[model samples]
Structures are given as structure tokens and as C-alpha cells.
Target chain A: MMGISEYFESARIAYQAIIANKTRAFLTSLGIVIGIFFVIMMGWFLDGLDNAFDKTINAIGTDMLYVDKWSWGGSDDWRSVQKRKPISYQQALEASKKMTTAELVAPHASKWGGKITYQGNTLGSVSIVGVTAPFVNTPIGNLKEGRFFSETEDVHSVEVVILGYKVANAFFPDRSPLGEIMRINGRKFLVIGVVNKRGTIITDFIDNQVFIPIQTFMGMFGTARRGVQIAVKAGSQELLDEVREETRVIARQVRNLQPGEEDDFTINESQMFRDEISTLRLYVWGIGIGLTGLSFFVGIIGIMNIMFVSVTERTKEIGIRKALGAKNRSIMWQFLVESSTLCLFGAFIGFLLCATVIFAITSAFPDVDFLTPYVPLHLLFIASIVSIIVGIFAGLIPAYRASRLDPVEALRYE
Target chain B: MNNDIIINIEDVAKTYQMGAETVHALRSVSLQIRKNEYIAIMGPSGSGKSTMMNIVGCLDTPTKGTYLFENENVATMNDNELADIRNRKIGFVFQTFNLLARASTLKNVELPLVYAGVKKDERQQRAFAALESVGLQDRTHHKPNELSGGQRQRVAIARALVTKPSIILADEPTGNLDSKTGVEIMRLFGELWKNGNTVILVTHEEDIARHAHRIVRIRDGMIESDTINPSPAEV
Candidate 1:
């Protein structure tokens, strides 16, 4: 093995050679720059997606299960699910009362495509969700301002509402919406609270929904025909499966299904959202890796071709060094250093470009939840390591060829 | 091999396979040299003088017979071993000067030491001393392209001498210079020889070969004459 000083000398020689041919070095490393840029951007995007997905799934409450007419995650046939009878508000209430392992149960009945108006401003295609006072204990039900409606207000059907974060922001940009009276379907309701910003790309509609008491909703729009979904939160994460099983039994009892009959309603959990996100992430990664691999392959070819040219151009120098007592390993190290330095330069440039783009995007849309403001530090580390590996792989053949040159013939080369 | 003999060659031959035919570059040659002897090997083109130089410098091994440098068999040495021997024991001066065009005169001279894993401070000091010996001390930072042909050859000489090798091997060292510049280089070789450094000159020019104390002539891959010059030509 050569000493560290010898390696440094080889690296010094390599640096001089690259500087002597600046244009060729830059052009040769262009492929590496673009490849690394694509790789870093893809990594940043996927990490943002994962982080946002985790936050949104947590907002949906991982320990909670939903008993609804429709199955989530596309697990059941749509036609069959639609043909099943809907869970009534009374049945939901009964099931909630019977669920022993649940921490709290919030029965929800939603009316979509409803309009909410404040002064001259109006938001179209908003969802109006009706739930009891216990909904405040759920994850998405956490308030950003003011307080949730009391059980007294819900029982008395006092027409109090909680606005979603975006709805509040749109309606009262200059002032708080806590005491403002808003009209939902032309009926007046005082805003008592504002839900926190808890929406991701998968569940962005949560931001456009307004919450009201269940009794008020049933009074305005008759209760017999509308279906209700029950949100059941487990006492602890460890009791989720037990709560789910108990909820299923309560639901079956509420619906009065025969022993042999399969329960009509579906019990959906946040795990369904996680599973879907993972599958989507797999596809994204598949395409991202495929594209990144292709670019790197092209980059490797570019560097290898240029290294071969460099070796040929410096044949006489190789001979001279060999004659000066340089071993084959020394020559190999010289070219390897040159190639890796080129790749490292390219990676720096690529990382800068990626950072600039990410900075521009995140600054432009500061409210965006799924785009991070800066690239992660670990991704930079990964890119540098990957670039060096690529450089070594690309420079291997050319370096070996340079090391094996016949000193006499190489010196004879013009 | 005698203790005083720095190089010993016995029935050494080299051949090249040219397609289906084998070309005999050297046919059964033998020679010996003491540690401080100054000699020149002279021949026409393809007369095996170049082959002898290659074998003596450890750049190429004999295909037959044996060659011993400092009592070590050169014929059976591996490439790395040959490289090590060349690094420590043989200094080569080429017809073209062969200085790295991009490197300064100092760096070009420091190349051998760099490969030998010498520390930077000592390498620079030694390389500077070598440049001073060749009267290129002031041009240490000048590149080969920036220097004259004679100056470039001096830099190459400085590089050759940096390692303080067992022998200085010059193959047509003045082949690329003008007559005056060529004479100046031969004078430098004479001074080195007078200072007790072993010098071997490989040249087709009689004027250059006459500078040495002894001359050996070859023809058709075999030595024709080996004679001492009673009084060497004045530099």
C-alpha cells in the first residue's frame, strides 16, 4: 500500500490535470450534475410526502376506528357497499353507548356541497359536518382558537358552529371568527371555535368543512333518511383491536343482524390510509428510482468516455511518471482521484440547484404542508457518497488501462 | 559477480514477435561495468544498442540469459520489482527531455521522490538542490514549455539526478538539440562523470560518443568493437 503522502501527491497531480482542461472537465461532469439533481429532488419530494402523510394520518387518529356504510381503501366492491343499508344516527348512538373499550365516541352526519356565507363573502362546495360535543376529544377536532360547543348547546340544539382553519382564514382574514355569526344554508349559527390546520394532500377537504351540533343538523334536514358514521376512539393504542372488535359487535347488535348474516357496515381505521399511502409511495419510488438510475447510467457512461480520452491524451505523461518509478497502482490512483473529484464537483452544483428550487417553492407557498422549506442534510450526505461510488465505477476501466500501459510505447506516443 | 561490478550481463538476448516471424533485436550480448565507469554504447539504428539500454535500465527484461544489477537478477524480476529498482538505481535522460509540460521545473524534478513516498519538505529541498546542480535554480518555477530546449534538457537532467541513482542512463540525450546546445549537454555529462557518477551514453553520433572514456560499437544485434579512448575528446 502507498503512504498517505503518495496519495496526496497523486491527488495534487490529478487536480492540476483537471484544471488544465477546464472545459472538458465541466462538460464531462454535466451528466453527473443533472443526474444528482434529479436524485436529490426526488428524495426531497418523497420525504416531504412521507412526513405530510404521517402528520395527516396522525390527525385522523391512528387509535380511532370508523364504522361507516362505505369501506375505505377500495377493499370492497363499490356496488355491493352502496347496496348495504346505511347506519342511522340512532343506531350509531346505540353502538357508541355499547362500545366498552372506547375512550369516546362521536357520531357524525355530514351534508356535502353546502354553502357558507359571511357578509358578502361566500365559500361554495363546502361540507357541513354535524357531531355531538364528544367530537372535541378526537384528533381533527382539536381547536386552534376559542372553545368547542358545550354539551348544553348540543342538547338544546343552540345552532353553534366551529369553522375549519381555511374557512375561517378565508372569511375573516383581518379579524377572529370566534364570535362572528355565519350562515350555513341560510340559517344563522354563531362560530364558537376554529379547527387547527390539519389537512394533507390526501385529506384536504377537512379544511373546507364546518362543524355543527348533530341535533341542529337533524332539525334543519330531517333525521330519518340521512345516514350517520360513528368515530370511536380507543382508550389506549394497545386497546385498538379490542375496541374495534367490540364496536363490530355493538354495530351488529344495533342493526339486529342474524348470526349467519355478515355485518353490513365497514369498520375502517387509519391503517387503511397508511396502507394506501405506502402503495402510492412504492409506485413513486419505483418510477423515481428508475429515472434516477437511467440518468446515473448515462452520467457514468459520459465520465467513462471522457476518462478514456483523458488517459489517451496523457499517455506520454503516464510513461514519464512510470519511468520516474511510479507503480501501476499510483497511476490508477491518479485517475481515480480525478474522476471522483469531478463527480464531487458535480454533486455540489446539483445540490445547489435542488436547494434553490426547493427554496423558491417553499417561499412562494409558505402555507403548503407537503413541501419542506429546505433539503434534508442526510440527503446531501447520500448524494456525495453516491456520486463518489459512481465516479469510481466509471473511472475503473480507464484507470486500469492507464496503469497497464507499456512505458516504452506510451513514451513513444506523440 | 564482482563486488565492484554494479552491472553484469551474460549472453543476454531480446526478441520481438513480428506477426508469424520473430525478430532478433539482440543476439547473445554480454557486458560489465564498475560503479564509477563512464562508457558509451554506439550503433546504427536497429543494431541492438537501444535493446541493451532498455535491459540495463530495468525497463525491459532479457528474453534469454541473465542480467544482474547490483548482484540481483534483472531477468526474473516482476514489473513492480523492476520499477522499484529503476526508481532507486537508474536515472534516465530521454531524447525528448520528457518533462511534464504542465508542472514547474521543481515539480518535474520532484516526481520520482513523490512516487517514492518522500515527505514534501525533504522532496522540495532535494529537488531544489538537484536544480541548482543543473544551473536551473532560478528557473525552478518555469514550466518546460516556458523554457528553451537546453534548459528543458537541464530540467530533465535535474529530475534524473534527484534520486541519486546508481547510474545515469542517457539515450540519445542530445538528439533533439542544436549542435551548440548538444555540446553543452555533453559537457554537463562529462562534469557528472568526473564527479564520480557512473554515466552511460547511447548515441549514434560519434561526436557525442567520443566524450566518454570507453566506447563499444554494435552492428546486426552483436558487438563489433570495445576499446578504451587513451585520451577522451575535450568537452
Candidate 2:
């Protein structure tokens, strides 16, 4: 028997049958469409979340690594991290001078709950960070409207403040905020700059905080000798590891740590961001693949159901073909082609719908990565192959049943 | 004539289980039919004429004894083997004009070749030739439902004749048609037989039975008589 020719003929016949019942065929494809729709949508949502996090990381500056006595955010130890001593200015200065890889090193001092008042309008209980001019070059102090303060202001320990964009907007919406006088914790400070409208985890980055020169913050709010952390910049991402190691050695010396004692600080930068995203990606693929699988199952079910109906409805046809000379394999292939065609069509429609929805949502709120169109070629390719496999399996029992019918009995069938 | 018997039945019996009891559909029936010989089996309901026809068509296996087609014993044949002989050797035309209602006349005629795994061009050409023989060439593309009863029966005859099987087992092939349409269908069968094809017509009507050169009467699962019609029914 010419298997190829037979299969093609049978497939053509089967396709004709499906076309004859367009409403049923289209409805069946809908199941597959809905299934793929959700799966692709999940991909877009995941991408949006990833983009938001990436923006946050970029906002913190690529050049600067946070050198702190403990990791930022919550503690892994919880108890031990709470008991740790703060990084001192002398240790920071020593680490800065020793690390040849560092392009800029600025000691950071923390002053909590600093109030900012501009005339009658005021925002209270905001985090007030005090750091030197290094932040000016780093992305952390990048501005939209006004420039960062000069190194001279930082050295003089001048009473000056840089308002966050939202903070300035709240008080001086129509006017330039630069050179305006604001009081930080009841102390007069000349507004030197306003930051860009940066996004945040919860609060708007610009609206939530105030920035003052590190030296002036220590002199006025707390102790001049105190340092909370150091904002250290490695010249490039490649130099970060080397700069971190050298700073560790210098910090140990400055802290007078005995040999073999665990180093007191970690250099937190790109690696942390990578690690976080790596973990996040695992969760994304896990959930995404899982949910996608469920929809694919629905596609399979639709194919199976349709094929079963097709077998019965075309009983006489199958019988007639059998009488004519159809091999069992040819009959099987006919239904297989039919089912796979339906499902693959569904996948196409589903992805199209996903694209339309993505575009619509992104147009409404332009932050969405609408054009990303994350159709993993391999996954989709595999899904299509699997759909075909499922198509064959779904067609198998029915095709067999069809081919097994007695020609004479079927011809005699009512 | 090849004079070689293409089909032979030796004391073949078939019993069907109907709920509580087994009904002997055919009892010790033995017959031999040569290729290209027209014959008719005639009997009323419950006479087992249909059962005998089924055994001859390879639609059912016998309960006892041997059935042979072209020296190949059919009683011991597997489903696939029986199917092979059925598809290649025996064509069937039903009393009710059992054409595939949804398929075109060409497709209905091509049914056997499709099973035979014939190529598309060959299947279509063969079906067209068969339709042409039954004078259905113009209506080849029409569905069974779209055709009149006479036309539908002609399509079914075309389907039965398309495979060019050894014997055409037609069971009351014209029972569904009006008298004039039925006579027309029988005339077509006479033409098929004249063209050197073996035609086996099963009908209880004596006039229809008379159309065949030989008639075998079956009653109570037994062959009551076999005789040649002196003056057969005129087409």
C-alpha cells in the first residue's frame, strides 16, 4: 500500500468532514484557544513583574555596592544581625583608601523620622539619608529637575537638603524647588536639589524620603564621628568582586578583627540582584509551565472528544473506505491529522488573542512589555508536537473502531 | 469460463445468541458458487436467507464446517483476512439503499478503494468508471440524500460494483424502491451480470428471485430447494 498517498487522501477526506461541521470544529478549537490564552498571558504578567524589579535595581545604581555590617532587608540570622555593630566612618575611610578598585567611597549615616517643612506644607516621618557627594555620581542621586549638592557643601557640613521629587512636588508644584528653604527636624536647610520621580516597592521613592549631606546630618542630628554604612563604588561591574575583597581586608584591619574571625561586612550589588531574579525565574517557570500544562490538557481533551464523535458520525464512510482498501494505519492517520489540525489552529488563535490583550493593556498603561511576546519557541514547538501526539492517541481508539467495522454489516447498517 | 469455484461452503452452520437462548441462523448449509455466476437466495423472514448471505459475504464466520474463497478457507480466517476477502472479493448492495448519506456518489463508490489503500487518482477514476457503468456519471458528485430513490439505489449499485469483487451480494436491493424503480435496478443488475460479474441477489419476492438464472430457497435455516428458472423474470 502507498502509505503516504493513502494518508494524504484520508487526511483530505477527514478535513472535509470537519469543514462540513464548521461550528463544531470552531467550538472545539475554542477550548484550545482559551488554554493557550491563559498560558501566554501568564508569561506577559511575569515579564511585567520582572521589569518592575529591574527598574528598582537600576534605580539603586550599577556602580555603587552597599558595604554594610549586615545584608540589606531582613536578616538571615535575625538575632546575630541585630546585635552587630554599625559601620564606622574611620573604617569606611580606611576601606575606601585601601581599595584601589573603588572609584568613589562615601560614608553613610542614618537619621530616622526626619521631618521636612516648607512653609505650611509638610511631610513628616520620612526616612532621611545622609551620604557624601558619591551619591551625586551614582544613580541613587540622579535627578529629574535639580542637580545634586557639591563636594564643598558635604565637606563644610552645611545645613542643606535635597528634596525627593514627590516631596518637592507636594510643596512646590509650579515653582522650582531649588534654593528654597526647608526645615529638617526643626533645623533650617537650604534645598539644593530635587530627585527624579523614581518608583519604589511601596512608597514613591521621591515622595518618601529626604537627602542631606552626611557630615551635616551627623553634626546636627547625631554624632559627627558616627557612620551607619558606606556607599562604595567599584569602577565597573567586573571590579566589584576585587574591590569587595580588598575592602573586606581593610575593614578588618580598621575594625581590629583577629585573624580567622568571620568578616563583619558584605559587599551587596549585582550578584544579589542576580540571585534574587534567578530564584524568581524558577518560580515563574514552575508556575507558568504548570498552568500552561493544564490548558494543553484541555486542548487534548477537546481533540479526544471531537475525534470520538467523528468516528461514530462517519461510520458508513469508514466502512465504505475499508471496503475500498483503507489500511488501519491510514484510517488512524486521517483522524490524527484532523485532530492536530484543529488543535494547532487553536494554538494559533490563542496566541493571537494573547497578543491583542497584551497590546490593549499596554496601551492603556504603557509600562507593560506588550511587544515582548514571550512565546518560548521551544515550548510552543514542543506543545505543538505534543498536541500532534495527543491527536494521534485521541484518534487511535476511534480510528481502530472505525477500521474494524464489517463492510457488509456497515453497508447493511441503517 | 475458468470453471474454478471461487466460493464453497461445506456443512456451514451459524448460531446467534439472542438474550436467553441461542438461535441457529443457518444449519448444515453447504453451497458452491463459481466466479461470474449469477444466483439468488430467496426466503421469508426467519428463514435464515440473510444468515446464509452473511456467511457467503464473509460478514460472519460459520459455527461449524469450512467456507472457502479462491481455495483460501474463510471459516478459519482472521478478521483481517476475512476483511481482505470481503473488501477484495465480495461487494454488497443493501435492500434499503445504504449509500453513505453524507458522502458524494463518487466518494461512496470510492469507499472500497479507500480501504484497499489505493492512490487518489486511481480511486477517483475507478469510482467514476463504476458510476458511468450505472449511468450515474452526471450525479457522481451528488450525495445520496440529494438523489431520488432510484438514483440512490443506482449509487449503491455503483458502490457495490466499484470494487469489481468476485460476487455482488445484494440483499433485497430494490425493496426500498417503487415497482418501476425496482425493475430498473434489477435491469441494471442483469447488465452487471452480462458484463461477466457474479451477482447474488437475496430476496423473498419470487419475481425478483426469477430474475437470477438460479434460485435457492432457504427455510428454517435450511435450503428447501434449488432450481433453475425456466423462464426468468424479464427485465
Candidate 3:
């Protein structure tokens, strides 16, 4: 067995050899640096996406269900869904009257690509939603300024509207848009409230919309052409399944579908979104991990090449040490230590570079809640472990070759 | 004489395969070396003097017959055992003064003790003493490239002496130095031998071999003569 002192001597020799060829060591380790950087960045990106998804899902309400003619998951063929009868406001009213497990019910009608103007500024391609007062009770309904339209406003067809965050910002950059009158589809409507900024990467379109009472929307756009969506909030998270079944049965009865007949309405929930997001997450991780794996493989090859070159260059040194009473294990350890030390240097540089990039992004976009400011400690730990493993694998063949060298031939090598 | 013998060889042979032909590097040879004996092995190229030196140094196992080092059968020893024997019992000096090129003279001298698992402080102390014996105490901090050929050789000699081995085996120790520096190295070896250290010199030069008390000459893979110097040269 080689003693600890011998191992230390080997490490010292290995360090000297690396110091002697600083440029070669640095160049060889560059692959490792890039590999580690890509791995950590990829992890951070996926983690950010996950964080954004959680925030969006929570805001949308996990126990909420949307009753619509079309499924949000697109599981039903579009032609068949289009052929189904549109869900009408009357049907929504009937379903709400019959529901027992719902905490609140919001029946809404929305039109995309609508135009709104304030002063001389015109914002096109805005989503215009007509909803009841119960819509304000949802998580995304928190107001940043003023108040939501009241039930009296809906009954009287009052021209009061609530602007989403981005719309409010676009119309009034330096002041509040509440109580200000804005033209919607060429008619003057008072902005009663401003919804808080609730935009996430996956659900950003919600911030580009304005909401008004459903009666006013029917007076302007007419209710005969499009479908009405009924959003039902379960009394409790534990009652979501029961509420959904109740809504489904009520919606079928409102549509007057007989027993054994297929229901015309689709009930959508946050779980559908979660399932789709998870699949998307898998694809992201697969591609990200695959790409990082490729980079690490290339890094291994780079380190292996350098280790072979180092062994060949130091053949005489190996022979000298062997002749001076070094065992084969000692020679093997020397080369292994050299290669691993180089990889560790690369990992450290990679970590520093990654940290700088994260810091720059967080500093630049301080309000970007999706991007965490600091690299997670586990990422650093993983980078170190990955680098050490790469170093060992890369050095194995070359170190073995060095250890197996015949002392006589090595001593004679120039 | 039998009890004093530290190395014993009986009908040792070494063979090699060169492509399609078998080459007998050492056909058959037997020799014994006793304690504190200064001897030289002399031969031209291809005369198997290097093969003999390799066998004696425990760097290679003999293909046939028995060889003993202090009554231990070295021919049957495994690689680890042979390495241990070499580390503890024999010191090697090379013609090229094979010191680590990047290490200082002190580090070069400490190489053997490092392999021997000696503690750091004692290794340094003994290495320094060895360098002092070779009159290179002041040059211990210089790298091999910074030193003259003679000084590098002295450092190599210090490394060889640091282990306090049973025998100092030198292969053409002065072949790379000038005549004057070569004489200085030989004088140092003469003093080491006078201090009761066993020394073995492998060289082709008659002048360098004359510093040893006994001369063994080889020709065509066999010993041509083994004779005492009667009056060894005093360098």
C-alpha cells in the first residue's frame, strides 16, 4: 500500500507539471467550463419555468372549473367542437341557479382583437371580456386601483369597465386610468378599476384585456353570435370533483340533453393545464439534459486528450520516479491528480461565470420574479461532482497507460 | 564470505523476442556481490552488461535460474515485493542524472525518501545531509536546469545516498560530464566507498571503471573476466 506521503508527493509533482504548462491546462479545461456553465444555466431555466407555472396555476385557482364549448386541452377535434351548440348566457344562468357546491359563479363573454382608445392613444388587439361581479373574487381579480363594477352596473347596462394591468399602463403611463373614460369599439366607457399585474410567461394575454358588465357587452357586440363561458369556483379544494360533477350534470340539464345523450359542454380545470405543462416540462428537461450531456461528453474527450499528451510528455519523469522507488499506483495517482485538478479549476471558473450572469440578469430585471437571483447551492454541488467524475473518467486510460509503462523503455524515451 | 554476500546469482539468463527471432541478451551468468564491495561491470553495447545491471537492481526478473538478495528469492517475487525491495535496499544513479527537471535540488534529493514513506521533516534533514556530503549544500534550492552537469550528477548522487540503501548501483554515472567533472564525481564515489558503502559502477570506459576495486568484463552475453584491481586508482 502506498502511504499518504507518497500520494502527497505525487500530487506535488502533478501540480508542478500543470503549472509548467499553464496554457495547455487552461485550454484543455475550457471545454469543462463551457459544459458546466451550460448545465447550470439549463437547470436554472427549467426551474424558472417551474416557478412561473406554479404562480400562474395558483392565480388561476386549482379548484376552479371553466364550462365551455371547446376544451382548453384541445383533446376534442375542432370540427366536432365547432359543430356543438354554443353555450348561451341563459344556459349559464340556469346552471348557476342549479349548482349547490359552488362558492361563486362567473358567466363571461369575451372577444379578442377589440380596439380601445384613450385621448389620442389607440391600443389594438386587446381582449375585451364581459363578466359579472363574482369574477372579481378569483385570485387574478385583485385590484390595483379603484373598484370592480357592481351588480347594479350589470343590471342597468352601465358603461363601466376595469382595465387589465398592461392596458391601463398603455393608456395612462404616468397616472391612474381609474374614473377616466376610454372608448371601447367607438363608445365611451368609464374605467372603474385596474387589475393588478398578474402576467406570467404562459398566461401573459390575461394582462392585455379589459372587463365590463355582460349586459353592456351584449348591448355593444350582441350575444347571439358567440358562446358564453361559465367559470365555477368550488366551495373548497376538497370539493372540486363533486362541484365539477354537479356543474356537468347541471349544464347537461340546462342544454336539455336526455339521459344517455352526450353532453355538449366541456369542463376545464387547472389540472388539465398542469398535465400539459408537465409534459412540456419533460420535453424541456430532456432536451436540456441531453444537450448538457453532449457538452460534458465533449469535455471528457478534451480532458482525455490533454491527459494523454501530458503522460507522453512526462514519460521520462515517470521513469525517473519509478526508478527512484515509486510504485505503479504512485505513477497512476500522479496523472489522475493532475487531470482532476485541472477539471476542478474549470468547474470553479464555470461557477463564477454562471454566478456573474445570474447576478447581471437579476440586477437588470429586478422585478422578474420568475428568475431567482442566486444560483442554487445544489447546482454548484452538482457541477463539482460532475466535474470530478468527468476528470476521473477522462484520466483513467491515460493514467493506466502511464502506470503500465515499462521503466526501461520510458527511461530511454527522449 | 558466504554470510557477507548480500547479492547472489546462479545461472541467470535473460531472453527477448525481436519480431520473428529470439535474442539471448544474457545466455547464462552467475556472480556474487558481498557487503561494502566496490565493483565495476564493463562491456560494449549488446554484451548484456545492462541486462546484468537490471537484474542486480531488481528492475527486471531473470527468465531462468535463481537470484537472491539477502537470502530472499528475488526471482519469484511479485512486482510489489520487488518494488519494495528496490525502494528499501537498492539505489540507482543514471547517466542522464534523472532528476525531476522542475524540482529543486533539495526536492530531487528527497525523492527516494518520499517513496520510502519517510516523514517530511526527517526526509528534508536527511536529504540536506546527503547534499552536504556531496558538497552541494548551497545549491539545494536550484533546479536541475539551473545547475551544471556535474552539480546535477551530485544531486542525483545525493538522492541515491539519502535512502541509506545496501548498494549504490550507478549506470555510466559520468558518461555525460567532461573529464575534469567526471574525475570529481569518481573522487566523490571513492570517498563513499571508503566510508564502507557498497558501490556498483556499470560503464564501458576503462578510465571510469579503474576507480573500482574489482572489474568484471562481459563479451557476447557472457563474462569474459572477473579480476581484482590489486591497486585501485585513487581518482
Candidate 4:
């Protein structure tokens, strides 16, 4: 424990030592500064990208489990497990009735090329989906205007349609699309609703899409006999695993699979999309943290080299102090303080550079909503600890050398 | 008659164990100095006068003898005790002026107080006062390089005196100075003696030696002679 004035005096000596040789001090701090700068900047950039990814995934739906023929997330396997025939629309209807954990089960049917037209104004062709009333509630798709078609309308095989918000905006910019007549794939359909501006979770929220009742869709453009997937919805996260298990068992029963055999279909959470984003996040962190660590290592090495020079240059000074009753530990502490101060200064500069870069990038890209300018306190904490650790580690050799210098030889040194 | 003994050496010796050889730097030297004794320790090169000074200043332990400083056996003292004695009882002025190169004059003079863990205000006041005593108060902020040889030596002297230690052990204090500067520095030491602090000067200069009340001469790791001056300088 040092008294305040003495502590400040020691710090002043360290400061003066660096000031006397500014160029050397800056050069020594260069590696560390660059290392941390790039690392922190990369971290912020990746965080922004991950935010974009999560928003894209969330646009599709929450709670809706995508039970398809393939695994839900990104995969490494080159070949898809030989395309198990797609789950049938009947099987989706059957599971909807059977699973106690399910809130709603939307039997979906779809095709990619559907040209939509409202009078003389024609919107571009898009992937049209045929779905149940439950889909609007389960995935919680937004309704920008009017309402989604009624379940009774699907039961009656009504020729009704719901336009995605983008389609409504593009083809009918000023007019209310509800109660208007539209044409889908040359078939007449009445516009019942316009879906709300989509969440930034999946795809470009402005991409054109149209939804019609599954019953009318099949009647109008014959069913493929095999549906792509039966989307299931769980009540809550607490029921997620349980609902998934029950859905799997029910799907097996509907598909007529016996016990002890693998089922034909896959059941997984909508969250799998976010998990893919997470694994990618891990890689981002890995690269960022590893690079930062490398810079820290390089910075510490530079500090160590300088400490050696400092100890040797001041060998006689250390000797004189020892002659005047300074202990080995005191000499060690002096050099440690010097080394630590250098590292702390470098860390402060590096963090500032990182923070500035983050701010600049966000300002440059205003639409990038994920950019957060405020650096987390944890990063500052980490930088401080790094500085202190570097001080102790880098100062060790010089401190030892200084402490071991014999008073007699030191005094004799010219 | 018995007087207060500040430094007592009894058959002290120092041997350096170099590779494949032993160099005898000190051999059975015995002497005593009471309080406030102004003495000059003089000898040729390799004569162990520096070695004797080191032992007297408690900077080194003797190889085969006892050194008692004010009745505390220095031979049995720990490093902390030696440091305590150095800071509290014996001040040192070196030949090279040994001021920390990057520090200011005030800081150089405050080094001992720093070791003594003195408060910053008191250290500054004391160091300033010591510099004033050496007639260097105006140059208190100047670094060694900015000062002349005489000024740097004054700063060194201020540092030596700032601790208010009993003995000012000056090893060739004026070795780097001109003859005129040397006499001036000797005059400063004479004034310090007049103020009642013990001053030990280690030099080969007979003129510098004449400034002290007693002279101890060494030759080849042993005392050649010890004598008192017939007529000491009147202050």
C-alpha cells in the first residue's frame, strides 16, 4: 500500500519515462492497439449482421414448428436424406385433431408462380400459399388492412384471397384492396384482406406474396397429393419439447409407422432458423476474440522488450536505490507500474477507436437498425484486466533483472 | 574516556569470490568514530577505501567481522534494517552524482524521502530547504543535464542532506568538478560540520583531505595509517 503522493510520484516517473521517448512508446503500443481495434470493430459488425439474420427468421413466425422432410436449420451433410416423400395434407389435418399439445395445425399447400392482377394494374408473380385460418394466429402474421379469409370461407371453398402488404402497396397504392376483385393464375378471387407490413424476420419483408384458402386452392389448381410440410404450433416454450414429442408420436401414427422404427417426417421448432444464426454468431465471436487475444499477446511482448531495456538502462539507478535502502520488491513494483501504465494507455486508445468505428458505420448505414453505438461496460472491464495482466507478465523479467543487480557492481558501473 | 560511538568496526574483512579466484577487498580492519566526527578516508586504487566506506555506510556486509553502528550490530542486520539505518542515520553522496537522469532536481533530491515513505508535502519542503542550504533553491526545478557540474553536485548534496541523516558519506563528491568547484564543495561540507552533522569525505586529494579533522589512509585492502590533524579549521 503506497501513500497517495508517493503513488502519484511513481506514476509521474512512469509517465515521464514514456514522454521522454514518445516514438518508442507509440511503437510499442502499436500492435496491441491495432489488434483490439479490428477485433472490437468486427464484433460490432457481426452483431449487426446477426441482428439482420434474426429479424429475417422472425418474419416467418414464432411458435410454428416446421415439420418437414428435411432438417430445419443449416446442415453440413451434402446429400439430403433421400427425399422422403412430402408429408400429405391429410396427415396435417389428422395431426391437428390428434395432438393435445398443439394450439393450431395449418395444413399448407403452395406453388411459386402466381401472377396477381387487380384490374389493369398487375403485380409481379410470387410464391402463393394456401393456408388455414389457424396460420394467421399460430405464426401471428400481420394484417395491414381488412382481415384474413374466414375458416368458413375455406370450408365452403370460397374463391377469396389475402394480399401480402407489399402486394397491396404496390398494385393498389391508394385504393382499399378489401372487397375488390382480383385475379390469381387466371382464376377470379375476391380480396378479403391485406396482410400487415411483415416483420424483418424472414426474407425481404416487401417481397410479393398472396394467400388463399387451402380448400379453394386445391379445388382451383389440383392438389399435388403430397404437401411439403404440416406446420404445428405449440402453446408456449414450456410446452415446446413436450409438444414436439407428442407431434412426432402423432405424426407417426398418422403416417402408420410402427414402434422401434424411425419416422418418415421431421418435427422441429421455428427457432432452428435463429439457431443457424447463432452458430454463425459463434464463428463471428471466435474470430473476433481470437484476433483480439493475438493483439494483446503482441502488445505484451512489446512491453516486455521495453521493460528489459528500461531495467538495463536504469541498472545503476536501481543499485543506488538499493544502496539507499530500497527493497527488491519495491524495485519490482516500480517497473511493474511503468509497464502497467503503458498497457492501460494503449487499451484506452484501442477501445476508443473501436467505439468510434462502430458509431461511424451506423451513421453511414442508417437503415441498419442493429447498430448499437454504446459499447458495453463488460468490454471496458475486459480491457482493464488485460492491461493489468500485461503489466504483471511483461514486467516480470525486467523486475527480476533489476532486483538482482548487486549494489557494489551497480555503483561501479559508469 | 568513553564517548558516544556512532560507528564501530572490529576486524571486518570482505572477500570477493570471483570464478577460480578470491579477491581480498578488505582484511581485518578495525576502527571507531564517535558522533559528529569529520574524517577523510583516502587511499590508492584497489586500496579498499570504497569498500570500507560501503561497510561504514551499511551498504554491504563484511565477510568475517562485526560492524556496529550506534551499538546495533550491522553484520547481523537484515536488508530492511540496513535500509533503515541508511535512510535514518547515513546519507550518501556519490562520485557520479547518481541522480536519476529523467527526474527533476526536486525529484532527485526527494528520492530518499520517497524511500522513507515521507509525505509529498514534507518531502518537497525538506528537499527544497536542503537545496536552499546548498544555495540551489533557484534551480530546484532544473534537471541534472540542465545544471552545471557544480549545480548537479549541489543537488546531490541536497538529496544527501534532505534525510537529516547523521553522517554524510561523500565518495569523491568533487571528483567530477574543477579545482575551484572542489574547494567550494569542501567549504559547503565545512559549513555542514559547523551545523553539527558528521561528514566523511573519501578522496585522494590532499587539499580535500586537509579540510577534515582526521585522516585514515588505506593501502592494498588494509589500513596503512590513521592520524588526527594538528590544527583543525576554525569555523
Best DockQ goes to which candidate? 1
What is the C-alpha lDDT profile of model 1 across A208-251, one tens digit per residue?
A: 89999999988888778788999999967899988998998889
Q: Score the docking of each candidate (DockQ).
A: 0.79, 0.31, 0.63, 0.56
lDDT of 2 by residue, A1-414 (tens): 445655666567767776788888878777677767766676666666676567667766666687786775543576776566777777777776776767887777666676788786678777788878777766667776666778898899888888776677778889898888888888888887888766654224434677888888877767544447777778787787787777777778887889998766666664466566667778877887777677667766777788888878777666655554455555666777787777776777777787788767766765333234344444456556655665666566766676667765665554
- Residue range B155-235, candidate 1, lDDT tens digits: 999899999999999999999999999989999998898888999999999989888889999888888998997888878
- Cα lDDT tens digits, model 3, A63-178, are 88989998887777878888899899898888888888899888998999999988878999999999998889876677998999889889999999999999998878899887
- TM-score of chain A as modeled in candidate 4: 0.81
Docking class of 1: medium
Q: Identify the candidate with maximal lDDT.
A: 1
> What shift in Å separates residue B218 of candidate 4 from its native position after superposition?
1.3
TM-score of each: 0.96, 0.76, 0.89, 0.87
Better of 2 and 3 by DockQ: 3
Ranking by TM-score: 1, 3, 4, 2
Q: Give the TM-score (vs. native) of candidate 1.
A: 0.96
Candidate 4, residue A103: the lDDT equals: 79
- In Å, residue B22's CA in model 3 sits off its true spot by 2.2
Worst 10 residues of 1 chain A by lDDT: A9-18
Model 3 lDDT, residue A131, Cα: 94
- How would you encode candidate 4's per-residue C-alpha lDDT over B44-127 as one tens digit per residue? 878998889888988889999998888889998876678778878888988888888878899888988888889888989999
